[model samples]
Target: MLKLDAYPQGFEEDDRLRSAFTRNLTLHFSDRPAPPSVDGAIRSAGVPKTLIRYWHDPHDVPDDVRACLASWDRLHNEGFEFRTFNDASATAYIAERYGAQQLKAFARCRHPAMRSDYLRLCFVLAEGGFYVDADDVLLGDGWRTIFLNGTLKLQPLCYDIFSSGMVPAAEIWRHDLPTEGRIFYVNNDPIAAPAGHPVLRRALGRATEKLLGNDPRPEIQATTGPGNLTAALVAHARDLAFAGAPFDFELLHDWDAIAETRWDLTYRGDARNWRNMDALGI
Candidate 1:
């Protein structure tokens, strides 16, 4: 069944964002109580459907996140689900995708590095398959169009500067970066993949090789953060001169496009909302 997993932790800030999202979703879509396969999961978990699932590692689940979940449960009638993977190693897709050597490169590093691990975990779930970031909100309630298509999808790593957290340092920062580098991630907001695509596999393989390499100047600082990942993708595309791939989907970057386009919906709220929120100085 199609399963949506939240990062093991770090939803405290996201909860409010999601609350806004949930409100908007209900207001906009309201097609069904839940997306396909989601209702059953909620019922099986025996939680209120309104609650947002906290799928991060136990330690990763922040207090604010817990509060958000609780609030979501109480406020919304719909139920939600929470899950975890006891075995990190088991989340691997490519046999050698994320080895010990590669993990240490960023494991126990900074939040950015940690965020990279989360992203890697998502890719792990995807196995180069397909997954979406917490944001990447939908518009006009056409989620089923992509979800039902039975294809794997992922947002590109590039496009926006803020969401580029998953970017490898070597690719972007050039010099060695501190934990602050994590902030520069490539947002995987609305990633997707076709049933059978080799790009995902290749991307994982490349990430694995880059991470496992022991050079002090590891290619891209052993990061596959969203921005770096997206940069790497474009770099690869330019190198191979390949085109017309599933990864070539749309990205909601520009303010104009984000505001004007009908498909401009995102987890961060609509462009006008973002602008207004920023203006409110909150």
Candidate 2:
């Protein structure tokens, strides 16, 4: 079992706690040979080469969210095509490809997390671009440079244990321990892929299956979130090897590179919320 001391001064100030957290979080591809250099990867992937974001309104954007938007705008100014889809447009796109029924079901999704999760997959699969969460700020021009220059990068959600302090270490270990003894969980927040990439296709299939089941209270992680994405990736890698296609994955950066804005002020009461609730042991 994992034993965690009470972080009296909070995790940010405690180096030991931070180190332990990082150590427990394993990257699956760390052992494999690194993928091709970023430039080579991007060249191979080809393009519409765009950036996509979904928002209800650009006019009423929040300050923190604006920061993220500005970063993307900077990328666009520098030459990348950036696209924003409001709710209506997003729904219409989903309807065209999946059906009106699927669109209605997606509309009824109460959780912002769930909605964005599904939309990002649909958008990326259809358009073949990068999807960055509205709240995730790009560190610098390097974010665009690295992505355009390199291959597809998967920033799978690190398991939530570091902040939640709820699941026991052994229990988490038993369920999440990678078969290779180490693997990273794919995150939905910043996913990029080529149009018709097999991995994204598989994830869309799995997500659609989950949605059709009408599983009341679909766990965010397992249904439209990282857990499902990770499973799809694992399947993709295995299938690719069998089919003789080379698959190599790499980390985007060290944990500290990207800055995440706190969400406590924005989503305080939502029980299903995941991001930025560190003080609540989430």
Candidate 3:
């Protein structure tokens, strides 16, 4: 079992129990092959599979963000492709393809951060490629290699405990937890998927529903952020499992060696960052 100083109120104890349940259920099915949809996606991969970035405008992009883009561009030239979609291009693309409803949701988003979440999901589902937030920098050739080899995999959908800090501890404890804290929440900053992957499609739908709803809360994480993405992933895993395939989702924990080298530039002073650091006992 994992140990922590305090679970910020009510996170870890329930997570501990859920983790136990999932393990017991799946212990005998560990070595099964991935589902057919996953296998088919791997085989039908297309390229130059894009590396997508969304920003307000090319001129407005920060220097740090530009540097990160450059890093990917350099690796991209070796054997991949990259594209940037500013507001205008992104807006038009959504309007043309996904229709006025999605386009309106994209525009109606009060926060720029929320707009970005919708844009990334739409672009990836439509064009089928990798998406990386401008704020994150690639560590090395691992990402490129994974794409080139068509071995890119989805991290298991898990809630980010750090994002749950604002929730009353009692509420968190009472909520049905998914997995034990053993899995890391898949960070949305870097993602790769073939065009029309079911996971991305489902996420796009969920995000659109939340955005178009009457909810007044402005929290992007719950509406269209990593938490939203993680939920879609969990659904996708369940679908696969129901079809008698193993839960073959590749998790970030499995890629620690490569992930350790990558960095989230925005994490430095955020309270959530400190919480995560504490959770990891770093």
Candidate whose lDDT is highest: 2
The whole-model C-alpha lDDT of candidate 2 against the native structure comes to 0.57
> Candidate 1 local accuracy as lDDT?
0.33
For residues 151-170, write the lDDT of model 3, one tens digit per residue: 22543333445565333222
Q: Tens digits of per-residue lDDT for model 1 on 1-282?
A: 101133112221242322222222222222223334322122221111111121334455444434433432322332223222322432342235455644554443233333333444344334332233222222332332333333333322212235653453123323232333233323443444442244344445455555556543332333444433443433333333234333332222221211112333332242223223334442
lDDT for each candidate structure: 0.33, 0.57, 0.56
| TM-score on alpha carbons, each prediction | 0.40, 0.69, 0.66
Model 3, which residues run further than 4 Å from truth?
A: 1-48, 148-152, 155-184, 246-249, 253-282
lDDT of 2 by residue, 1-282 (tens): 123333222342233443333333333344445334343223434445687886665566666567666765656554678777766677778988777656865775556567778888887777787787776666743453335433456663433444543322233334445333222355666776667766677777777777767666556666777777766665555454455665643445432254354454343354435442333443
Q: Which whole-number lDDT from 0 to 100 does residue 158 have in model 1?
A: 16
User: Which candidate, 2 or 3, has the higher lDDT?
Assistant: 2
Clashing pairs in 3: 128-195
Q: Find the 10 residues in a row with the least total lDDT in model 1.
A: 45-54
The full ranking of all candidates by TM-score, starting with the best, is 2, 3, 1
